[model samples]
Target: MPSSPLLPSRPSLLDDLAHAALARACSAFRQSGSESFALPPVLVDATLGNGHDAAFLLSCAPPEALLLGTDIQPRAVHAATERLAAARQERPDCRVQIFCRGHQELPQIWAELPPEERQRPLLAGVFNLGWLPGGDKSCLTRAESTLAALDFLLERLMPQGCLSVHCYTGNAGGPEEEQAVLRRAAALPPRRWRVAYCRDANREDSGGRAESLVLMERLPISRREMRVAGLCQA
Candidate 1:
């Protein structure tokens, strides 16, 4: 009998379990707002980049929910701004605020908006960490800065609103930053917040051999909260 070329020399049970757990976690959350809202809450794409996450979040929020996308790269800000502006045709009331600064500057940017818009409830924030596509590698999110941004998010996000961090391990500092953030996530007091992780089990995706999506929420004693916490490796 000819040996199969791809067969593993040993069992990979632990890897299989970890992968399945992560897959289940990503599927836990249902998409918000089936249609739209009259005055939606606020959203932040802390990494901005191409504004894909920001655009999607805006669409899912209430019709009037405003959005602010910030990135350290000027090109990213421009790209996100342009993308969001174009996406707004379908969501006119969805105001967009683009900032050319580090994600840590979110609080300052949020404060600078008009009183009425700034006062809107923040639904959830998104962070796609890594270099701006085709941009300088040095400008990607840092560990210290990311933690600081999460602190800001926790303070500003409305109850039950979440913060999603898409961590990339295949790039500079991405693995280290993900580790630092996860360590911080582990210590988050149960009374104040919950941590979640989603990873594909099969490593079948073309993106990479593995990837992880992290979502953090502030909620006390809820079914969702418990489920999220249970998914955390920390």
Candidate 2:
């Protein structure tokens, strides 16, 4: 995968893990077969900073996939849009949507999608939470907005689909946002969702605060649970 010029020369460890998770999710979704799942899997970059992650997703996603991205900063959006131009040209079959809006607005955006596009199974969603790298530090993602977006995505994530949240605890409001994310991850019912929280205990790279990654996968409901929920015949 090509690195975006807007990003630093060295990729962060959190980024490496998030990218790996996304790649595995995409690969797994492809191997799951269309007969058992929806065609053209849908993936989202919830925090599209410079289009680096979006580009990476485009490379790994199924040939006929929908890639949605959102960013709160116009400059970030512009940079990402520019960064993805080559990839989009290379992969004409992949549909890409880049929104210059906050992740919190995802519900409204999702509501506006065509019924067919809306019906496509969301296979994965990745969030790099904090502020845009090399952008305004004052404009940061808040816990309320992040949680709202997470709630919406979690409800729609397909079975075996995963959500990768990379939280940076270095900036203003970052700790609060990370704490909120941890709380939500902890609250998910284990029967329906598998969640993991990882952090470096010995390293404090970002202003003496360690970064964390929260990975959550949606588990398929058993037939008994489906019957209990009235989703299947008794």
lDDT of each: 0.66, 0.84
Candidate 1 to truth, TM: 0.71
lDDT of 1 by residue, 163-234 (tens): 777777766666778888777777777777777777657674344345567767766345464334332111
In model 1, the worst 10-residue window by lDDT is: 21-30
lDDT of 2 by residue, 1-234 (tens): 977667665458777888887787788767755444535678999999988889989988876889999998999999999999998988898999999999999999999898888877788899988887788989888999999999999888877788999887887788888889999989999988889888978867558468899999888766576445433345
TM-scores, all models, native as reference = 0.71, 0.87
Off by over 4 Å in 2: 1-9, 204-208, 220-234
User: In model 1, how many backbone clashes occur?
Assistant: 4
